[model samples]
Each structure stands twice: as structure tokens, then as C-alpha cells.
Target: MLPLIDGKVVDITGPGRTDRFGVTCTDLGASIIAPNGKLVSVFGDTFSGRRVGQGDWRSPVVLIGMGDANHEIVYEYAGGSDPAYARQLWDYIHDDAASGWRRGGISTVIPSDLLRVGGSLYLHAIVNHGFGDVIWTEIWRSDDSGVSWTHLGEQAKFPADLHDGFAQCWSWDFDPDDGWVYVVATGFQRDKGIILMRVRPDQIGQRSQYSSWGFTDGRWQWGQQATPITPPDEHWGELTLRRTAPGKWVLGGFLASSYALGYRVVSSPVANMYTTPVQTPIVGSSGSQVAQLYGGYLLPGSRFGVTGGVGVVVSQWRTDTGWPYRAMQFKAKLKDTSKTPRTPDPVNL
Candidate 1:
């Protein structure tokens, strides 16, 4: 049974989108397990395409909820400089000082991004903006659940450097093996496109010392400099990294054309390393991030006409800007073709 919150029972089968309340900002966080045997999802809300200045970026807060049903478990924000909005959502719609965290009024402020690592939570937020444009990547942890927060570093600590020196990190996932945290960023130096980076989960708020990877030169290279993965004319749908075989890894992301975006698979000696993304022949459209859970099972993603694996499911969607504002799901059977070629082009031609 799905959980309920605030006396409201959320029905997953019910239609999503409860009336466009201020354009549901894009959210990012980790796929995690909760204390109550439930999967926990953490994310932040921000504008779709516009920045904070274009309109008032109000009600700065970080949200936590049950992963399957979207039942909001906790809504966290700062008291003074970073305000919490759940205490007032419907009634205090646009009230600024009603919760705190707004300085130059609500119209000029935007909060930071949030990430979870090891067993703790971290946040990187924008403090003040202007000629120099200062920002901070602050750290916070909740040992007893999301009831209280302990602020860990200085405010506006690492200006314009953490998320590609100006780019904001939109999606992030962590690998407990090497303590490396990966973040997928959209805006860098203001206008650069999508890029990927690797950081130590322990380095949050320390310095912006993450490694950058590029899908260029017919391969991937590490640098402080990076090139966009999705080319100009083409659109990238979704990206996911999952462990399919024991010690065997898969890095998959989808692309959309007028016809279809098929299942493409690429293997690397290391989980995140890829010379170039090899496209497979299975044709479909609008792909999604894949999660490998419970002994070689694909947890979420779909390719029609594909079947036969126990405990597998997929999430498909129609997206605007290659970023899925809304997602639809499909139940699929994952097949093992390890003995066969992943691509028809042949392994090493």
C-alpha cells in the first residue's frame, strides 16, 4: 500500500498535475532507501527554462517524498536566508517575508541545488547576485530523519565554480564503491549545453574540484573543459547508469528522431567510462533512465515489443527540451543477450 500524507491519500493511477501551480520546477536528487523500508526520493523545485530574475523565484525549499507514489514526506528550507515553504503553500502563495530567506524581496532570489551522499544531505545555493555574482554550496545532514538540519560549511562558499563555474547541476547519482558522485549539468558559463562530471561525495562544499568528461574525439576525455554530448540538430532524451551484470556495467541514454529512439547499450571497463556511446538496433521513442536492481533486473524503462524477464519495468515519456517535465511508464521484460553482439555493427570493426 502507498503512504498518505497531510490527511490526503494520493492515488498513483489518478491523473497527475494538480493544476499548474507556478509551473512545477524541475527536481533532482538521489534514488535511495528510507528508514521505513520504502524508497526515498529527494529533489528541489526550480523554473522550467527561465532563471530567477525573469520572475520571482519564491518559496525556496528542498523536498523529500516516497519514490513510488510521490507522497511528500518532508519539505525543508532555511529559516532566515533559506526559507521553508510547506508550512504555508496554498494560503501563503506569494508572501515573501511570511517565511524568511528572501533578501532583495522574493523576485530577485533563487535557491541552490541539493544532493545526497553516503547517508547525508548537501545543498549548494545562490546567495546574492550582481556584477560579481556570488553563490554558495552549503552542506546539511539529518541523522534522525528530516526533522532538523545542521548547516555544515560557509555561505556562498564556492562562487561560480562548483557547478561548472556558472552552470547548475540538474541531475546527480552517487557510486558508493569509490565514493565518486556524478552530476549531469545543463547550464554552464551561462550558455553551454549538457555536460557530465565526477566528484567525490565527500567533497561537497570543499571546492569545485570535480572531473569533467566529454563525448568527443570519438571517445570520452576528462578535463576542466567539456563539450556537449547532444549535438545541435539532435536531441538527447534521457541518461542512466546501471549495473546489469556482476562487475559488468551499462551506460545508457536515449535520443529522439521523427521515427524512433532505440535501445542503445555500451560497456566499459569501469562503470562510467565510455569511449563513445554505441547505439543498438532496438527501435522505440522517448527513452528513460534505467535502474538495475535485484540481481540483473531492469527496474524502470521501456522498449515496445521487448519481453520476458522477471521483475522488470520501464518509464517512458514525451518530453519538452529533452528534459521530461512529465513521464509515462511501461511494463517491459528485460532480455539477456550477453552472448550476442549488443550492436549489429559488430564489436570491433
Candidate 2:
């Protein structure tokens, strides 16, 4: 299922202030695709390292994944506050993969999407407190892989019958046919475009077992509530939604008024997400003439066995000069019209 060819942008974090690892600009740079395939990125504020116009807001929180044996682990968040004023968890190590990554020893959890399943690892976080008030999304459970974590507090919220305030929890996967674990949230002022829940990889931390994904009358039910499988003009922001092969699935994100980086493969993520997808253009959109994209993660080994190429790990918001939120790496190629024919909208549930 590797097809995505639009290839060219390769900068894998660097230039946001000479970058070496002190990431600049900041944004939810979630990524995951390890287990030997490599590509673990995770970021959300590194502006203190300076370079996006000089730096001063030290709210460090970065990690690059793959430690313990495969080596190459670059963690950060050495207790400088801002996990909502310190939830404790410090680890700042940097062996010079570029003078920019540190923070690897302590973590109260801030990762967003890390999946492992069977042997257990799962992260998919958000539990905030650092200035945004107190966001939610939570779900942490390590068996020993990520060292230690157990907070399984809030798994899915913000469905106040369909929306009333906040929600966060973007990107998730683990649908071996139907075993569950779908996720892909939105709301928190995103206007409302994406939604779909699932849960059952052993009750993913049990939020009453999780369900959502309803539509009524036209069909496609589940528990009968959640909607917008992405259509309200599609304003989703930092997304990922996996499953690239057995029935395809895709999703990808960043379309807040055409800021570019779009995608939508669908064969079933509950099918029909309003078709008409496949739009690149990052680096600040306007058709990405180059320079201003933002977190478009898609690497999980590109999904299904080798077939063409498809890596994605975008976030080039450097804005003015040379380093602001750097972390680029592209290798697209899946455009044979992406296969076309997606029809399935009337499920009998």
C-alpha cells in the first residue's frame, strides 16, 4: 500500500534556529512508526531554544523515539514547567544527534499516539494544565517499554451530544478487521469536522468501553451519537488516522482553511468522509509553493508492505527566516487517483 509520491521535502527537524534539537516554533508534531521502521517524532513547544525570532518561552517537550536497543532516542521536557506547570517527569539527554534533543528521564505523560497493543504500550495523550486551563484526552499505559506510566483517566470526551466545548485526541489506529481502537478526534474550536471512536483493544483503558460513530436514518450506527466523519468544510487540524492497507483508510490533516496538507483514502473509517481528497501544498500553503506547513504525520512504515513510497512527517512553520518549527521529511507517491471508487455511504448498521 505504499503509493504517495509527491516527494521532495526532506529536512527531518533542523533549521529552526540552527536547530540541532532545540526545536523552535512549536505545534503538535505527533508521529509514530517504530518497531524497526524508524520515525517516532513528538513535539509541542520548544520555542525556548530560540531561533523563531530569538526565543524566550522555554516550554520544552520533545521526543524522537526508538530507545533501549535500536538506539536513537531524543527525549526532552526536563522540568522547566508547562505540562500545565509541571506534572513531574524529567529527562533531558542529547548525545549530539544535533545539539537539540534532551529530556528523557521523567514523564508524567505528554505523548500523542504511540501504539503497541498486544504487549502493551499505548500513549495517545493530552492531559494538560500548562496555561490552556486543563485539556483532556488522556490514556497512558506502559508495560515496561516506555519505562513507566499508568494514568488511564479520560479516554473520550467532548461529545456533549455532539459538541459544546472541548475535545482533543487526534490520530489512532489498531483495527485488525474490527478488534477496535479507532479514535481521531476534534472539536476544541476546530469548528467540528472529525470524530469517530472505538476502543476494545482490551477496553483501551475503559471509558465505559467507548463507542460513538452514529448517523441514524441513513444508517451506520454504533452507539448512536457522534457525527461529522469530517465534512463540515473539513477544518481538522493536526490529524493522522491510520490503517493504510487492508481496506485502506488514510486521513492525514491540516486543512484549517486550506493551510494545505490534506488526505482522505477511505474504504471504511465508517466510509464516506465526503470524498474529494488528496491535496498537498505545505510550507505555508497557497499551494505550498514552499514554506509554512504544520504537522502532517503519516509514517508507520507507510502502512502495508512496500509498494511505492509514502513517509510524511511534516512541520515546516519557520515563517520568516530559517527555523521556527522545523521537522520535515516527505516521500509521498500514492496518486493513481488513489484508486478512486469509494462509494459506501448507506450502511445498515
| Worst lDDT 10-window in candidate 2 | 78-87
Clashing pairs in 1: 78-82, 81-101, 112-125, 136-156, 160-165, 167-187, 301-314, 301-315
Superposed by TM-score, candidate 2 places the C-alpha of residue 67 at a distance from the truth, in angstroms, of 34
TM-score of 1: 0.48
Model 1 global lDDT (CA atoms, 0 to 1): 0.36
Worst 10 residues of 1 by lDDT: 5-14
Off by over 4 Å in 2: 1-24, 29-45, 52-92, 97-179, 182-199, 203-239, 242-250, 253-260, 265-277, 281-294, 297-314, 317-322, 326-349
lDDT tens readout by residue for model 2, 280-301:
5333223555457656777655
Please count the clashing residue pairs in each candidate, in the order shown.
8, 34
lDDT of 1 by residue, 80-146 (tens): 2223332211112332344573444322223333345545654443333432244433345544333
Candidate 1 stretches with Cα past 4 Å from truth are: 1-31, 43-85, 88-102, 105-116, 123-140, 145-147, 155-166, 188-192, 214-220, 232-349
lDDT top scorer: 2
